[model samples]
Target: MATRDDGAGAWYHRGQVCCTNRKLDEALACYDKALELSPDNPLLWRRKGFALIKAGRYAEATVCFDRALAIDPDDATAWQRRGYALACMGRKEGAVACFDQALARDPEHILAWQSRGWLLGTLCRYDEAAACYETVLRIDPDRGSAAWHRERMRERRDLAALASEVREAERFMEVPACIREVVRERDYGNAELARAVLREMVGQAERPAVQHR
Candidate 1:
């Protein structure tokens, strides 16, 4: 029979060592043994959740985070881990909510902020996503990835606006009633010229209302 640790200290030390050695399964087992002895220890549960995540058991990791959060609702680390696990599981909304909770607890939490930005980007909230990336840049000026993401978000916004303009141009090109008779009666000397005139008219009509600054 595997004996459980009566004191949380020994189990925590062993678990940390196992984790440091990259033996995630053994680390998780040690954490489990610790939790079995002290079910109310939020830190132990949080450690277990992290080890489970390292083991690629994201859903189970989320459950362990939930257990830790239930024990101490103000645990920001648990909330952050839960958010990461949710994001890994493709639950963007849930991940956003969890990240929000983590940020509420610790406003300076960089990972939570970055995660929120990523989730916002995933949801097509480009402006908000850009804001989040900017926040990260403010905290760490050398954050190259955040800068790259911010640029991509700006490009996506510009591209979406351009695409909308193109669609509007297509809609405007539907043969106008006033031009229908003229188009039917007049034969241009060159097919290319007729197509060029039509394209010019469509472009004029579909000019986007907003100008990019």
Candidate 2:
């Protein structure tokens, strides 16, 4: 690390101050100055990437993150930030992969879990998404966003599962009446004792489907 006496350190501090003040362009300038003095500094590269992301220069931010990762592959925060940049650019699959990389290095990374959950939800992988949010809630029980999203994902997953079961039931009903009778008699009850079990199943499933809408 550069000492306070070094020009690079001074510049890096200035960049941090600017970033804290939301002066992203000025922060980028200071980071560039620091990088000029210490081009091999991965921290400087990552800081620049964060400034670019704040500016909505996602493509440039990704390039800076790429440079940072090339310098140090084990940086979980850099990987997570890179995923965020990719997500901003609409590269969702790429973002998810980057989040996976971050989690591989640090399973307790809350932001990575949250971001992955959001992406999975967008992709309609509700069960997996809900699992991610469940992990987030376990790690930080006060995370209201994660808690809210978890419930939403669970509802969606349940609806999807129920719909699939209903479809299977419909298909089963379409089978030969002989087969249906056998199934009904074996699993449900004899016709003398059964009260239209298959119809009841379909009706229950369809009720939820209607409520989901």
Best by lDDT: 2
| Candidate 1 local lDDT, 168-202, one digit each (tens) | 55564664443343334432223234445556777
Score each candidate by Cα lDDT: 0.79, 0.83
Q: Report the poorest 10 consecutive residues by lDDT, candidate 2.
A: 186-195
Model 1's alpha-carbon lDDT is 0.79
Candidate 2 lDDT over 114-197, as tens digits, reads 999988988889989999999999999999999999988876665454445445776644433543554434432233222244
TM-score of each: 0.74, 0.73
Q: Candidate 1: where are CA atoms >4 Å away?
A: 1-6, 173-203, 206-213
Off by over 4 Å in 2: 1-5, 159-213
